[model samples]
Target: MPLSEYEQRVLEQMERQLSSDDPRLANTLKHRGRRSVGRYVAAGLGAVVGLLMLVFGTAESMPVLGVIGFVVMFAAVAFAFANPHSHEGPQGVVEEDGTVRPAGPGASAKGARAPRSGKQPKAHKPGFMDRLEERWDHRREDGR
Candidate 1:
């Protein structure tokens, strides 16, 4: 359900206060929104297609489309299922019994894994055409 105007106002006030104090808390709040409806549709379509394939007994060829649908539906369902909205105050990090901690020096919780070592490096290989495209992009960005 959508928030009422009054609820929205309250939410906005809370968000502003939270954001002003700790930007990270604000960032987390920014992501709260309704889940995509497309996911449920995709999942339903996939199940139907898979069922049709089964009924037709064309398991070899016709089943491919059904399998594809299933994959798409699974992806959509996964996205929908992985909701980040929580009652937890910020960063989804909460103390036992669910209280938000104020941000401060040494505020970080223990046992958090250090950021992973460099898993990706910039690629240095750009062909002539790629460089030209990059230059074009830069020109557009510069409005020149």
Candidate 2:
């Protein structure tokens, strides 16, 4: 169920309070939603280059080059995956009882946003599956 306007305001206020109280904790709570495609592409290319280098080195009887290629590939893959901004969710944010809540609505989950313009972005309409789920939930709530 969607939050009422008052509930949403309260949540926003709490978030703001949390941020003010512990900026570090608030920053840590924020999720980095997704990574760019370029990172994956570079990693793939690096792997392919490494494989080609390994094959060529073997054919030409060069062990040193093969080792270098392997190192390069490993470094590239590590660099791509080790980015701090790639993390998601609320794994570190702990409650008073040592429980973590999944980042919910209004939670600071930063990712790519559409460029701002004079016009507001169109709201997404619920799909057939979503409507069906809503109906099912309503029925369950009514003790059907």
- Identify the leading candidate in terms of TM-score: 2
Instruction: Report lDDT per candidate.
Output: 0.59, 0.70
Query: Where does candidate 1 have its weakest 10-residue lDDT segment?
Result: 104-113
lDDT of 2 by residue, 1-144 (tens): 999999999999988877766656676677343456777898889988988888888889999989888887897788678654334435633443345545544354543244466877767666445778999999999995
- Candidate 1 lDDT, tens digit per residue, 13-124? 8777667556665665665554456755666676666566554545556766666656655554565566533243555455433555454343444323344466665466
Error of 2 at 97 (Å): 34
**TM-score to true structure, per model:** 0.28, 0.40
